[model samples]
Target chain A: MEMLMNPSQMTKKYFTPGVMLVSLIALNGLIFLALRLIFGVGAITNLDNQHPWGIWIGIDVAAGVALAAGGFTTAALGHIMHREEYEVVIRPALLTALLGYTFVALSVAIDLGRWYSIWHPLIFWNGNSVLFEVGICVMIYVSVLYIEFLPIVTKKFIGNVRFKGMLAKLNSPVDKLLRMLDRGLDKTMFIFIIAGVVLSCLHQSSLGTLMVIAGPKMHPLWQTPILPLLFLISAICVGFPMVIMESLIASRSFKLKPEMHVLSKLGSYIGPMLGIYLAFKVIDILIREAFVYLMVLSTESVMFSIEIIFGIILPMRLFFSKVVRESPLGIFIASMLVILGVVLNRLNNFIVAYNPPYATTSYFPSIGEISVTLGFVCIEVLMYRLIVKYFPIISIPEKAGVFKTKYSIQGSK
Target chain B: MATQGRRDFLKSLSAIGISTIGVAGITPSITKASPENILSKDRMGVLVDTTVCIGCRKCEWACKNAHDMPSGSIDDYENESVFDNKRRPDYSALTVVNKYQNDKTGSPINVKVQCMHCDQPACVSACIVGAFSKKENGSVVWDESKCIGCRYCMVACPFQIPSFDYHKALEPEIRKCDFCFDRTAEGKLPACIEICPVEAITYGRREDLVQVAQEKIKNYPERYNNHILGETEVGGTSWMYMAGVDFKNLDFPTLGDKSAPGVSESIQHGIFSYFVPPVALYALLGGVMWISKNRDKKEEN
Candidate 1:
């Protein structure tokens, strides 16, 4: 609700010795991205007619969108569900969602053969297409997330309106604009928040619809008519866990006290949602008589088993334990499992179980494809670091003053 | 020619009727018929008699020549070395003839592979920009002008027919058999259909082809298999095949009778049907907002 640290108290250091590794990886990714753009997708990727979509769609778009579910999920929990305690994590979750969606859009752009025509979806209306719904919803939802994020940006610069040199003359107008924007955003914030949540559900489910069209091509274990529902539920189930995971990771990175009290309570919600997802998943498979396929020790069955066992069921079982719920390490592990589970589920749906009937050989992402994906993620992390440092995205704890000055030197969380 | 062009245009106008008939919105599996039949009652189709195919790759050559691609020489295609490995139709080639050894017949059964051009093509439904259309003449064609080259059509096509010009950096096109749409509109047979020496492939109305296929199968039951490939597969395809052996042996996908778009469209349209679910979802969010607002107000008081 308030700025965690004063602008003056914020760390001035932009780079550290440890940042070299991230820079190198990000550089490598950017290079591949350039190669892909110049030489075309065929030069950088193994994708063929048989395997048209690779990791760019599977991990970067589908999984990326699902993992970013924390934004809308936390918004609903903190504001709509009336959970005041989750307010601390809400800013970070929202920030994560904003950056995550941006990356998803960028990844989609690079993946498209005609990247310039990315704007075609905006002008062209193909309502019957599942992807059309996803494209429209994501475009609108990303804009909503940015609008919801505006207050934080305004909070940082609203008061400190002084600009140096030539810009000094226009500072007052800018400041006035910021104040007016802040006030306007305050009254209308609820609408955008509500829209973000609604739009999220639509597009999150529509990602699943993208795969449903590959009905016969997709393996039975992953292909179901209720794929959209499964995708929506899995995304919802992963939301709180993603928030918890992000909070813990950030705390550890910044050497701040883990908000175990707020997070442990968040932990309580995970099991029930996971249980509901599992129930529907099991029921859907059973109804379709697809469970028989799972019994086979084939690649598809093994991946499905790992996804359900290690990803969903394990986390669900772990979260129910009192020790797991109370401890930060326990909760973190459980959250990671849930996150990985959702990631695997998406990968399985879009890639692993997708066996095109006519394909002579299986598809694997080329080095360039993998690099571009990694680069997008690294860029997301770097951007997150930059934004959180500059903007008051993380709420300052009431007792944070004791450890504040020392942690500021350790740099952005 | 102008009247023929107008008739063709009018036929296409009718064929462009997008089918909205799908199963009720709730039951997950809402099946929608492909917009194939909307254009015309007399959609033209091709019927292939696989048993009679000579495994000569002349169809491939003719297809290239008709499309203005370099066919080299007709003699070059006669080299059987190309069929040494099972080759798929690719960027340069629109159609391919594959020779599969039929164990029962003790001879090779040649199958010509091209776009099946479904009555309800999966590509038509999958194209986000509506680049692909199932014409009244039973040709599933894609408009390059409208194509964004997302390659979803490649993924969605059941026959795996649509090939991308991946090598082209600036101008990539989805290359597939368009059922010789331009030639067909000009009242000319497709080059491949005109060039087949043994009459292995027959060009006619789809309904008439089905009847012809049935008559051939009934007359020479020993020579033909009762199963007609693409007759009912994926809600039927414009390109029908009558093979002497199992279609699977010839690289035909074992698809169910249900059309590819049926299951997907059903789920998508059903969920967003009449915009009811999304409106209801928005209402629920609004309700949540109201309750939350009221609780915060009470706390403040």
Candidate 2:
């Protein structure tokens, strides 16, 4: 194991001042207060009966969950696939998943009308409802995520002799029992991993299935039985690219070593997934006989075309190209495009493309809604930074010379 | 070597067995509706003659009054310029009359839009909460009390009929025409049929309605189109239409015979029915995990 950074250096470099963090938290709190007090959803939001869900459901929840898919995808690749090189990025991806899911839970709390009655779904089972399936699955998966993160938390908290001794006395036979439980959990980790994958698949598809019930209210260009499948496939495609984006951003910001090798390897999976996704997307449109609608250059059609080109086709091309896949900057740009694509696809399905002929209302998220979303994102980033700082998250460390030289140069400057 | 091979075979068999077990646990019980139940031969419905409609908005008024809904004044319809553009059902309005210009008639056709009340109502099937249900007499009704307000019925209604009361704070209802299920239960015609001045909207047993529609087309070949709208669309609606011109000219969607619920529910059940894929996925992951764990153990030894 590499030597730890001295406490002073760690504190100076890693931890942002508490005041700045608190101010960010306060800003979010103020937004929450405004949402609760000043506005019913209509006062602040453009949502109507036509567009029931908006940016909160589409981007903040759906896209957020898809981005979090990186956790299971990476863990499955590293631990299950036994690609040990990818193991370095696993914990960060897990951290991302944890934060992403927490944000989804928060989004649900904000969006639900009877927010207090949220527990009813947990207590009462509506087996037939797709939302019920999604709600239950997401709730369970979030718990599973934190359980997966337990070892990292324990390793960080239970440090040397003093902490170990304190824990040891309390541990007793229960300690041995707990260790056995951990081993059993590790052995059965595949069950939860598979369960997570299954649940994610079910809920992600159900997210699109939620729109399937919208009938003629949904623009014909997007309304089809195949939407659920498209959503599931797109989620998997988005997962790898999101991981790349998150890792690259973290590496650049923290002056950590880049994981270009793993990212480029991930490009191989993403390229083909995008290809399969685009192929099926075209087939779905054709089969539904919705291709004719695309011929008319209406606003909906134009937006649809732009979404396909910019979100799917362009990103796929960039990802597939060897030169672009290998370059750090190229991969980063492609990852951004992929992320943008997923967001646009979800937003188009949920908001922009939802047309109720009786009620021709448009939605732009209120400032409060936008602030809450941003605040949730900030919280996610803060949690990630804190976890990585305290826990042995990423396996590859910054070269000693590189770290020293950078700090010395910064001091001199 | 022989024992090792036997053990590997056993492992593979157990993996497959585990997957099948998992799938069996979650698969929905397939209780197919009897063919008699499936086919609604005696299904009753209404046939609206759009050419005869006077744009009186009487149906709208009668439906609201009968259902005890809040009435909108003439100004509400006029200010919205509802006639200028085709209007659909709203949270407050269960039905609407829209003026459609037909080149064949060289005049306007006032088409009243409401729930088609499909023979196989997608809204009924798509509703997991049992909020929307089809009655024995053929009317599809919604029980708002059971609704968790998930709005699946809104999405499932091919006619775009179900409208939600999104503005309401406490208890918002999903508003749509129930084919006047309550009035029909009392052996009375729907409020719209009772109040229609022109007799443009006729309510009866759907079979009788179809005959009535055909007889009108046969009697006035010039006035009515031979085609009976909703006779086969989305596997037949409880409500049908007879138009002077082609239905498409009036902005009616030319949907296929396959019901929306049939397509979606089939896919839902097909993927989820057997629980096979998830089980298979688990077995694959488990096998891989076991192999890796064993390899690690060997290395340690």
Which number leads on lDDT? Answer: 1
DockQ of each: 0.27, 0.20
Q: Across residues A87-176, which tens digit of lDDT does each residue of candidate 2 receive?
A: 556667877888899989877766654344556665444344566667877998898887777654443333232325557675455555
DockQ of 1: 0.27
What is the C-alpha lDDT profile of model 1 across A1-413, one tens digit per residue? 22233222225355766556777789999999888888888998999989999999999999999999999998898767756556677878988999999999999888888888888877666656778778888999999988888877776787799989999999999999998887666655665676788889988998998988887789999888888889999999999999999888777765567778888988999999999999999999999999999878899999999999999899999998879999999999999999999999999999998998878889988999888888888888778778777776665455454322110111111
Of candidate 2 chain B, the 10-residue stretch with the lowest lDDT total is B27-36
Residue-wise lDDT of candidate 2 within B1-301, one digit each (tens)?
Answer: 1112336534654775676676466434322331125556676788898888888888888889888988767445435366876667877789988887777757778989988888777777666445666667777888755665556566567777777766554455678888888887788889999989899988777899888888989999999889999988887888899987888878787677876566555566566556665566666666675576467546647
True-structure RMSD, every candidate = 9.5, 6.9
Residue B276 shift from truth in candidate 2, angstroms: 2.0
How large is the interface RMSD of each prediction? Answer: 14.3, 9.0
